[model samples]
Each structure stands twice: as C-alpha cells, then as structure tokens.
Target: MSARTTLRARWQRLAEPTLVRRSVVSVLLAFVLVWGVLLCYIFMTYKHTITNDPGLQKYGDALLVSLQDVTNPAHAAAAIDSTETWTYIRRRQIGIFPGKTLHALSDADGNPVFASHELKTLNLPPRHPEAVGVITEAIAEGTVYRIYTGHNARWALQVFEPKRTDAAFLAYNGRFILPYLLLAMPFVLVPVWLSVRNGLKPLQQLASRIARRNNDDLQPVGFDAQHRELKPLEQSLDTLLARMRQKVERERAFVQDAAHEIRTPLAVITAQAHVMARSQSEAERTQAQAHLEQAIARTSHLAQQLLDLAALDEAQRPTPRDLDVAQWLRAALAQAAPRAMARQIELSLDAPDSLTTRLDLPALESVVHNLLDNAVRYSLAGGTVAVGLRVDDGGTTLQLAVQDDGPGIPAAEQGKVFERFYRGPGHAASSGSHNDAGHATNGSGLGLAIVRQAALRMGGQVRLGQGLGGRGVGFFVEIPLAARRG
Candidate 1:
C-alpha cells in the first residue's frame, strides 16, 4: 500500500470504542500535534539562528574592524588579512572548504578592491546597496549562505558563510531528541491504560460484590466512591436496595397476616362440616347444615377480601382522564341505595353537573363502595347516609366526604380502623348497623382498610371526624386532580 493510504487507515482507527485504544491514541495525538508545530518553527527560524550566531557575528565584526579604522579609502585594500581575520574565518572550517575566503570587499563606486579567491569564482551579483543587515541566499545545489554586509566612510564590508553548519546543528537535535521520544512512547501509553483501569476500579468492585451476594441479601452496597461521577451511581444503587429490602419485609408480613386471617374461617368451616356429618336426627342435621353454610360464607368473604388486597398491591394504575365523577358516584350509589333502604336508612348523593376529574375508575370505585357500605351498615334506621363531592383548590383537587349518622368511633380508634382486618369496639355484633332480619353482619373488617389504600393510591388522604352535625362518623377523602397526559 502507499504510505498516505496506510496513514489514513491508521487515522480512522483512532475512533474505535475500546478504552485502551482511545486512551493510547489520545496521548499519541497530543504529542504529534505539538511535535509537528515545533518542527515547522525550527525550519522557519533556521536562517535567523545562523545569522544571529555569536561566533559568526563576532567574526564578521572583526573582519570589518580594519576597514572602519583605515586612514584613507584607497589605502583600505592593504587592511585585508592585516588583522589576521581571514585566519579566524578559515579556522572554524564552517562550510565545504576548510580554508575558503568566501566574501568580497568593495568601495562606494561598486569596485571590488579586495576579494577572497574563492568568493570571485561564483560570479554572483553584488549585494544591494540598501541591504544593511545579515540575510540569506541560495548559492548552488545543497549550498546556502548567511551573508552579512556593512559600510564605513570608504569601503563596504561583506562576510559570508555556508549554512551546512546550521543543517548539522538541526540534525543533531533531531538525532538526540526524537528517538528517545519514540522509545518512551510505551511508558506514556501504558500509564494511560493503567489510569483508565484504575478509574474503573470502584465499579468493578461493586459488580463483583453484588454478583457474589446470596439471593436473600438485599442490603445496600454501602460502599463509598472516590470519584465524583460514581457518587450518584452509588447513591442510586443504595436507594434501590433499600426499597427492595423494605418491599420484601412488607410482603413477608402480609403473607403472615393473610394466613392468620384466612385460617380462622377455614377452621370453623372444617369443624362445622364434621358436625353436620355426625348428626343423626334430621332436625340436628338441618341445624348443623345452617352453621356449615354460614362458615362457608365467611370463608368465601375472607377469600374475596384477600383477592382484593392482592389486586390492589399489583395493579398498575392507568393515567386518569376527565371522568364524570358525579355520574360514576351515582351509579355506585345506586347499588348501595337498595341495601341502605332495606335497613330504613336513606342513601343520598350530591354533586354538581358532570363534575369532571381525573381518576382511575376501578380503584376509585373500590373507595366509594367501601366507604358507603360502612356508612349504610352502621347508620341508625331513618338516619341519613350522604355521599358528597366537592371541588376545591380552584379545580385542582376533588374531595369526597361520606358522612353517616351512626354512632361515631372514638377519636383514638379512628387511626386504627384503616389497619387490615382491624375491627373497632362495638363495630360488630353489638352495633345497631346490621343486615336485614336484625342478625349482626359478620364483616371481615377490611372495608375501611381498602378505602384508605385506594385513597392513598390516588395521592389523597382519608380523615375521620364528626359527621351530620357532629352526631356520627365522617370519612373525608381528598385527592389531587390527575395531570393531563399526551
């Protein structure tokens, strides 16, 4: 391949994604940019360095000293080699010749009165009269010279030296400086790769530590980072681990609680079934069968409650839309109104027309159903169980208050009501609120728990206070309006 083609191909590989390659290439590129600029500068100043040489400038001055001190212009020719200046120029052996006199001295009339034997052989043009300082000129193949010219009252002084000495000097620097730089390249590039690996040490350690962990270990990494870029990553891992650990603990506790809750009804069922099977008389069998049916019903209720909890735990809520909440609430109330009327309690719903808001319909439906059911079942005959929706915060929030004129719960018990399967004092058999036929309604005590969870999922809170002129309990739910999604 051509040299240019090879270099171009090598240049394109600098962009490869391997870290070691990038690091080594970057270091080499920086060195090349600086070295190229320095090479250009050295060649550009080659002439200046030669003309300004202390030795060359001093030799020229010494040769011209005689012309300046001569008593007459015509007699100045005798000053040639009089100060032994020619011997000084020849002693340096600067050019191709060891003893070449390479300049000519002339008068103001352009007549060469004293000329070096070698200088006359070139047959070159005379120096410009106005050119007063040192300059450079090309003499022949592979030959260049630094020419110095000066004048006094009588004679013009010229001194010349070949530039081979300057080339030799530049080459000297190239030989001593360049090769070591190339040889030391490994020292430079090796350190770059080492630094990249060193910078990534914390990350490698983090991965190994996590990979080696047992499945049950959900603890935070807890490792501090030395680099600023890694700190945020460390914190994020710690946060995720903390959340996972907490979730695991919650799941463990929930399984235990659910098992306990379901076990009681199931045990009752098994015992009642055995009793029904053992009964000999028809009347005794009928009575035992009734008990068995009730036990089965209770177990069924417990299973349904567990299913609801499971759904609430896993269901990803959809983005809320403009819901005619008033309409949905009325539809929800229609289902409860018949149940309330059976107990002679009035079920009433009040809201503005269409009352649009963002809400997950199923979750919100659960909240409505649970709160209203509790209200109707607990209220006294002929008492009012009112469901209401009030828009506030300039339409940014919607408040739902389910107020009933039942015997209100004590302030201390209000907080505990939202707990799973938690039943308050006088909330069961002794309470006036029961299903028709006056038998106490056997509840799983999950109604208000479901209500609280649903409210929280909607970014809201449930507050218990006085209802219906401070005569009974009021459960107030407040939720933020759902943000519009594109």
Candidate 2:
C-alpha cells in the first residue's frame, strides 16, 4: 500500500470501536476520579486539624503562668516583654504558620497590657475570656483567625493564627501527589489492554480463516469456535455458505437443461432450410416449409417458457390485493377461447358470481394461464375442459382446479410430469401427427413445471388426480387466505 493509504487505514482502525480501547479509557477515568476524591478529603481533614491546634493552648497557659507572680501591673507587663516563650511565639509569626500569628495580654477587666505589632495597629476590642483552654474563631480586618485564650486571676492571654486558604494548600501538595499518579498510570493500563486483546484472539482467527478462502469455495469455515460468544457467528456464516452452494448448483443445472432442449429444434430448422433449397417440386417445397414453421414455433415456445422459469426463480415475494377470483377466472377463459375453438375443445368455468379474496395477482395469473394452456392443449377435438374456483367451507383456503376430458397421464408417470422439460411417452416432438391438434399435442413440457413453481411461490401447493368423468388428468391448487394477506 502507498504511505497515504496505509495511514488512512490505520486511522480508520483506530476510529473503529474496540473492547481494548473502551476498557483502558474506563479504567483511567475511574482511577483519576478516585484519586481526586481522596485528595480532597485529606486536604479538608488537615485544615480541620490546624483550626483546633492543641499546641497553641499550651503556649497560652505558659504565658499566663509567667505573669501570675507579678503583683504590680507594670511588673506584670514587664514580665511578658522578656519571657522566652513569648519570644518563641513572636518568631513563629513569620516562621512555622503558613500566615501570620498574633498575641495579646489583658488584666481581668479586659485592659490590654501587651499586643503584637500587627494586632496593636488594628485597635481591636478585647475578647471576653472563655473557659480556660477553650479555642474560638474570630474575624477581623477581613481575615479569619483561630484563637486560643487562657486566663488566671491575675491575667488573660490570647494567641491568634490566620486560617490557610484552599488554593495555598493545593499549590503546596499537588507537586508531590501528581507525580505519583503519573508514575502509576502505565502499570495500571498496560495489563488491562493486554487482557482485552487476548480475549478477542478467537474473533481475529475466524476473520483470517474467512479471508483465506477462494472465491469459488462455498464450504463452511473449518475453525472451531472455542468461545461461547463466537459460536453463533460461526454457525450463521456456515448456514449462509450452504445456501449459496445450493443456488449455484441450481443455476448450473438450469443452464445445461436449457441448452440441451433448444439444440434439437435448431438442428431441425437448419435441416429443413436445406431441404427447401434442394426441392425440385412445389409439393416438396410446401412440406419443407411446413416443417420449418413447426420447428420455429416449437423453438419460440421453448424460449418463452425458459424465460418464464428464469424470471420465477428471481422473483421477490408477492404483494397481494383484494380480487374477485370468479371474475378473474372468467376473463382468463375468454382469453384462451380462440385456442380452445381451434381444436373444437369447449372451455367452461364452474364458479360463484363473486368470489372475492386477497391474492398475488401475477402469481395467480401465471398459475391460471399455464394450467388452462395444458388442459386445452391435451384434450381431443369436441372434448370439454373445466375450470373450477371456490373457497373451502371454513373460508381459510381458496381452491383452483383445472381438468380435461382426454387421454390422462398414467398413474406411474404423474409424479414426474411437473419436472422441467419432462414429456411423457407419446408427447415427444416427433410424434406430432398422433393428435389432430398439431403443435398443441407436441408441448414444450414446461407448462406444468411453471404451474407448480408459481403455485409454490404464492405459498400454495398443486395436486394431480383424475380429470372430468374420471378419464383425463386434473391439477388442483390450494392457497391459504392468511398467507395471501401477507
């Protein structure tokens, strides 16, 4: 393949739906979602811990003890100025805490003795001392603070630290967690992709087997499907191949039969032409001309029937409509009237005035025409051919029958009469003089075959039996009302 074509094929394959891709995408999404929720929960828990820091209360208690011994208010204020614990608290204002911290000292009446530089500038009112060791949150100057207060009879002390914001927490921690997730992704995804690919191996093998088959080979695939999910696909493909083989065989047989049947009439036509050219008398020329005409008529009839059979083979399902069957039958008889009159044969229909039913028009027409042709052709001069149409008493099926008062087919040969191009013992093309009806007696033998096939296509069946007066043959076709409606 050219580079462009190869690239296009690769892109199409990637765009196609695959189990491996779906599995990998689903796993990756779930992994990221779970990790995100866990990180959020951890961040919230850490914030809660910092808001209630127990170590801040300890520092407050120590500051209160340092001021307890100084009776003079100036001495009390001076003691906090030089306390190492206070100095350590001052250093942490810019050190351990993410934001600033503040400290305050007050007497029992809430007069401020000392305040950190930032806290003193704010000029905030003294907070009422809570129960010793209690922590509370306060908002001032648009900043939230977690405050710890401690008090004795001599003094009240407070410590404050600003609460950290969510953005600051994520910025500090994401650098560590994101790398771990990226490092873990390949380990999780690679094995999942491999497992999905291995599970689909059987389907790939089945496709490869189909691709390797020759065009003429309609045999079933030999690959044994071990997976339960793949068995139905294998069976369906085999069923389709079997049907294709059957259709091919039928077409081959039809072609061979048509070629064989047409050869005899063609040879006769060629021979008759030669005889007419060589004839010396008017009587001889007339006989040669007559023979040539008969051969041509027979060949024409055979060709028409061949076309009809081929068309029936390829026809789709019929579309049925409501039709007055009795009226239709009478019209068919009128069309066949001249042919019947040629042989002095009488055509009659025995039916009700208006028998309406749903039926496939073309299929019904084919069945009627072929059946009438056979009955009229086979009957002797002055004989009667009867056509009957009626619905059964229950009205579920319509029955059509045609019979002739002539030499009937023997019981032994009746079964073979419907085969294509099948002529009985006395009906051969060379024995045209046996019956008074010249071309009528020498049939192409496709009428009954066409009748049976047309009937079958209409979801009906044909039966062979005794004709009128129990002397000649009869063909009965039965079609179901329910099937016709469909």
Query: TM-score of every model?
Result: 0.60, 0.63
Per-residue C-alpha lDDT of model 1 across residues 282-354, encoded as one tens digit per residue: 8877887787788778768767766776777765876766778888888888888898888888887778767
Model 2 residue 275 lDDT score: 90
Clashes of each: 0, 0
Where model 2 places Cα greater than 4 Å from the true spot, the runs are: 1-6, 16-196, 315-322, 356-358, 380-382, 392-396, 405-407, 425-441, 469-471, 482-486
Which one wins on TM-score? 2
What C-alpha lDDT, on a 0 to 100 scale, does residue 200 get in candidate 1? 74
The per-model lDDT (C-alpha) reads 0.72, 0.77
Error of 2 at 325 (Å): 2.8
Model 2: per-residue lDDT, tens digit, 32-142?
786787688878888777556566677778777777887677777666656635555665764534555677778888888877778766654456544457777777787
Clashes by residue pair, model 1: none
Evaluated at residue 408, the lDDT of candidate 1 is 71
